[model samples]
Each structure stands twice: as structure tokens, then as C-alpha cells.
Target: MTQSTIAAPGRAGSRGRSLIGLAAFVILVDVASATASSVTLPQIDGWYAGLEKPWFNPPDWLFGPVWTVLYGMMAVAGWLVWRDRGLAGARGPLLLFGLQLGLNILWSLIFFGMQQPGLAFAEISALWIAVAATMVAFWRVRPLAGWLFVPYLLWVSYAAVLNASVWLLNA
Candidate 1:
């Protein structure tokens, strides 16, 4: 084989590794956000335990597992879109994703950290719209990537309702 031929496989391998690294980096951001949000879990336990939740309020244990799955899916969805479009190509959708994720982190801080369910409800309302917009943008770029966001959207919808309920109950 010519030198160029020999170099082709090496290049492909490097690209594959780069993509994997990028995916990992995306997942790491989610994990870090989750970890930071979890810092209030202990205090949240005490506060939440005292609250008069609505009849539909889920058990506290359910959130951890549910969010773990959702975050995993979120990272994969964003990574898929990023892989397809790169940063420059997919700037809008990815920006929406980041905004929603930021809102997600903020919700935890507001409800759990600051113990303000009412404000968290308002923030989550915006987050719900941002998630939908991100999903639509992802759909336009890559259908599968958009489909991956379905569960996340559904959960956030449910969470939004829950947040509203909590706000109302405590108000």
C-alpha cells in the first residue's frame, strides 16, 4: 500500500476516538450537573419530607433513577446531533439543549437548594418550552437524535406539572 493508503485507516481511527471523547465530554457535563444538583439532597430530604405533597407526588426515591436514565438519554441525543452537525453546524439546536439543561440545573437548585417550589415551577415552564424547541431543532437535523429526546421531554412535562402542583400545595 502507498503511504497515503496506510495513513487513511489511522485517520479514521483518530476520528473515531475523537468522537468518543466528545461523547464522553457531553456525558460528563450532565454528570457534573447532576452531582452539583444532588448536593442539596440531604437538606431536601428534610424539607421535602415535611411538605404536603399532592396525591400524585412520586416517592422521593423515584427521582434519582428516573433522572439518571433521562440524563443518559439526553447526553446521547445531544452527542448524536453534535456528531452529525458539529458545533458550528448545529449551533442553534445545541444552544437550545444547553439552555434547557441549564434550566434543569436551575430547577434543582431552586426547588431543592433554595426551597422555592413556586419559582422553580416558573423556571420549569420555560424549560419545558426550551426542551420542545431543542427537540424540534434536533429533528430537523437528524430524526433519530430528535427521537432520543422524547423521553426527556415527557419527563420534563411531568415534572413541570409536578412543580406546579408543589407550588400550589405549598402556597
Candidate 2:
């Protein structure tokens, strides 16, 4: 067999390994954001428990499971985009994903950590826009990836209204 033909399988194997590594990297980033946001958990029973939440506010226990699923979906969405088009090829979408992720973490910090619902409402508003932009960008790259973000977008849309209500009630 020619040298080029002999190297084909090896290249394919190497590519597969690289893709796995990228998936791991993407998951790790999401995990890090989750961890950072978890820092406010201790405050929930204290500050958050005292807040005048709207009737629509979900039980505190529900948020953990819901966020876990959302974060998983986000990681997969990002990985799918990267897998379909490598980092360089999908830079714009990836950047949008990263921006929304950062904003996601910041919302937790501002709302729960600092106990500032008003400021968090503003931040989450920006986050809502970012998520929408990211979803559209991801759709352009991979339709499935974009679809994965739909639940997240809906959740955040609800959260934004919840935030506004909380701010208004408490203000």
C-alpha cells in the first residue's frame, strides 16, 4: 500500500481522539461555571428565603435539577457546533456561546450572591439577548445545536419576567 493510504487510518483515529478531547474541554468549562454559581447556595436559605418571591417562583430544589439539565444541554450544543465546524471555523458562534455562558454565571452572582434583584434583572435582560443571539448563531452552524438552546431560551425568558417581578415587589 502507498504511504498516503497507510496514514489514513492513523489520521482518522487521531481526529477522533481530538474530538473527544474537545468535548471534554467544553464540558469542563460548563462545570466550572456551575461550580462558580454554586457559591451562592449557602446564601439561599438565608437571604433568598426571606425575599418576596412571586407566586410563580419555583421551589428552590427544582432549580438545581433544571439547571443541571440545561447546563448539560448547553455543553452538548457547544460541542456539536465545534464538532461540525472546528473552533476556527465556528469562532463567531462559539464566542456567542461563551458570552452567554459568562452572563449566565454572572446572573447567579448578582442575584443570589449579592442579593441585588434589580441589578440582576438588568443583567439577565442582557443575558436573554445574548442567549437569543447565540441560539441564532448556533442555528446557522448546526440546526440541532440551535434547537438544543430552545429550552434554555424559554427558561431564561421566564426567569427574566420572574426577575422583574422580584425586583418590583422588593423595591
Candidate 3:
């Protein structure tokens, strides 16, 4: 076979491996954020158990599965963007994604770890905005990526309301 033909397959394989590596890195980042937020799980049974949650507050058992799915979607969404537009090209959208992820962790820390639902309400409101912006940015890059974030944005919207209710009821 010609050198050009032989080298083409090697380049394709290298590109595929790089894409896979990028996907793994994105997933690891998201998992790390989830793990960081989970540090407050002990307080869920200790402190959160005593809070005056709204009538609509979901059962504790539901949170784990719901968050697992949401985080998976978030990782995929981010990877899709980066896959389409690399880091430099997708900086703004990725930054928005990171902001929302950080806000997600902060909300848990404030509400569960610090036992400050009031402060968490403010943080989650900001998170909602960040998620919305990230969703829009992702949509601009890849429509499917944007679609993946819909559930997350909706969930955060609901969580924001739930947080406000809990804060008001307890305060």
C-alpha cells in the first residue's frame, strides 16, 4: 500500500483515541464534582432530616438516581461541545457549564453541609441562570448537546423553588 494510504489509517486511529480520551476526561471532571457534593450525604440524614421541607419535597431515596442521570447527561453535553469545537473554540460555553457545576456543588454545601437553606436558595437561583445560559450556549454549538441539558435546567428550576420554599418555611 502507498505511504499516504497507510498513514491515513494511523491518523484516523489517533483522532479516535483522542476523542475517547477527551470524553473520559469530561466524565471524570463531572464525577469529581458529584463526589465533592456528596460529602454532605451524612447531613442528609442528620440535619436535613429535621428540616421543614415543603409538601412537594422529594423523598431522599429519589435524589441519588435523579442526580446520577442528570450528571451523566451533563457530562455528555459538555463532551459533545468540546468534541465539536475543542477547548479554545468552546471556552465560553464550557465556562458557563463549569460555573453551573460549581454552583450545583455550592448549593448542596450551603443547604446540607452548612445547614443554611436561605443562602442555598440564592446560590441555586444563580445556578438556574447559569444552567440556562449554558444550555443556550451548548445549543448554539450542537443542538443535541443543548437538548441534553433540558432536563438539567428543568430540574434546577424545580430545585430552586423547592429551596425557596424550604427556606421560607424554616425561617
Which candidate gets the maximum lDDT versus the true structure? 2
Ranking by lDDT: 2, 3, 1
Model 1 CA lDDT for position 145:
77
Give all TM-scores, in the order shown: 0.84, 0.86, 0.85
Error of 3 at 95 (Å): 0.9
- Give per-residue CA lDDT, model 3, range 142-170, as digits (tens): 99999999999999999889989988999
Whole-structure CA lDDT of model 2: 0.82
Residue 25's lDDT within candidate 1 is 47
User: Which residue runs does candidate 3 get wrong by more than 4 Å?
Assistant: 1-15, 22-26
List, residue by residue over 5-124, the lDDT tens digit for candidate 1: 233322333576556746774676666566646755876659888888789888888887887777877787777776666666678998998888887888888888888988888888
- lDDT (10s digit) by residue, model 2, range 1-171: 444323332333356645675677567666756665686688878987888989999998998788878888888888777666666667899899889988888898899888899999999999999999999999998899999999999999999999999899989
Best candidate, TM-score: 2
Better of 1 and 2 by TM-score: 2
Q: Which residue pairs overlap in candidate 1's backbone?
A: none
Model 3 TM? 0.85
Q: Which pairs clash inside model 2? A: none
> lDDT for every model?
0.78, 0.82, 0.81
